[model samples]
Target: MRARTAAERVACPVCGTASVRVHSRYVRRLADSAFRGCPALIDLRVRRFRCAQQDCAQATFAEQVDGLTFRHGRRGAGMQAVLDRVAVMAAGRAGSHLGQVLAAKVSRSTLLRLIRRLKGPERVTPRVLGVDEFAPRKGHIGAETGFCTGQRNR
Candidate 1:
């Protein structure tokens, strides 16, 4: 386990006060990328502190790295790193299965949710939009496709 935060001082995001004291620390396990067939776990010991500001909006918040967020999840950030790779190199059930094999403990639906989380919201105002769902192969009863018939947005 590595120290999540050192003695380096951090000011409150909402305030400029840098007077804070370390109160305690805890470990958070996150999934990281995989090597071959094995998954990696990142054990981060997060620190807790008390803000000395009398009018601060927030009393405390765990420090976050550039690509990480607190309370976003309990799984390791490494898991999302791996999920990102799988999402890019694979799609649909295959990616889901790969995530499961890596001990993500996620099902196909969960995997899709993870993918959607990574993708975030779509903001494109395209001239045309197409939505469809299809069977993995063919000759399946659940095969479906969707197409937009609306005019192009300006």
Candidate 2:
């Protein structure tokens, strides 16, 4: 499918100044989620707006649609979310197969990259700690004992 952005004015990312000047326009080919068991593609025409601020670091910035597009993204947000879920659940090879079955068509390496990009879950301190010592041999006088520790979250 083909579509174009209709935003009249967009704010500059660096200076926060709204700009209505259009520097150029380009088409971004995005892979969208499956539609009725078929792969979907969106050719979105986005405008590049020139920053109005004189001291802004960014001279031109492309418009991004909320819940649909992101910076340097080739897939739609919905498809990205689906792939993220698959990456978390199945991991590399399995996640790639799952993505193909879902009509997303991603590679195992891509899934692994996605997994690597994800932030790890926050660590929580355990509430209870237990320690125990066990001897290697019951009757041996020179046997060494090993200590083991365990923790409980709640």
Candidate 3:
């Protein structure tokens, strides 16, 4: 599908200044989620705007459509989310197979890379602690082990 952004003005990522001046235009090809068991592609025509701020580090910036596009992203946000979920659930070879079944058709290496890119779940300290004394080696008098446990503040 071919489409163009309808935004009249967009904010510069660096300076946050809304710019209406068009520097250039380019087509971004994005891989979208499967539609009716067929792969979907979006040829989006987006504009590059010249930053209005004089001191802004960015001279020009590309306008991104919210929820549809992101910086340096080749896949739509929705499609990327689906792939991320697959990567987390199956990983590597399994994920690649799952992607094909879902009509996404991504490589195993890509799935692994997606897994690496995912942020780990937040760590929570255990509410209860358990400790026990034990012997390291049976029939060895000097081989003994010990453990320590303590409460943690939230």
Candidate 4:
């Protein structure tokens, strides 16, 4: 079912100006959390407001339902949160399997990509690094490019 917001105005993100002038309206399709083992959809009536701030860089901004969804995001915040937890809990394949059971239903590659996009460990200076040495390729390892290795036949 489609739903409309009770709000009449929204603040601009860049300039913090309250705008009530409606530039346009559209139905934003969002994927909500599964219900009783069935998927759900949210057809939200989103309104675009024209920014009145003269210095504001953004001309138009769409209304966002806080804690419910984000701009251009396909899934609801709750489902996205669950996916994030799953991505952190296990590796790609494992996380994907867990998500399927949890009703998130994300793919392995997507899970892995999400995990990779998250912030990494904090910065720290390395004291020491261990390594296993191996022969360099091409036998030109120590030889200059001007001269060939060993001896050349006349």
lDDT of each: 0.62, 0.87, 0.88, 0.78
TM-score head-to-head 1 vs 4, winner: 4
Task: Tell me the tens digit of each residue's lDDT in model 4 across 28-141.
Answer: 878778888676788988899999897789999998889887877888888877787788998588998887777777899988877887889999866774231222333433
Candidate 3 Cα misplacement greater than 4 A, ranges: 123-154
Q: Compared with the true structure, what per-residue lDDT tens digits does model 3 show for residues 44-123? A: 99999999999999999999999989999999999999999999999989889999988998999999999899999999
Greater TM-score among 1 and 2 belongs to: 2
Clashing pairs in 3: none
RMSD values for the candidates in order, in angstroms, are 10.1, 6.9, 7.0, 8.0
Model 2 weakest lDDT span, ten residues long: 145-154
lDDT of 3 at 12: 100
Candidate 4: where is the Cα deviation over 4 Å? 121-154
TM-score of each: 0.58, 0.79, 0.80, 0.73
Specify the poorest-scoring 10-residue window by lDDT in model 4.
130-139
lDDT tens per residue, model 2, 1-154? 9999998999997889999999999999999999998999999999999999988999999999999999999999999999999999998888888988999999999988999999999998877754422333343233233342232222
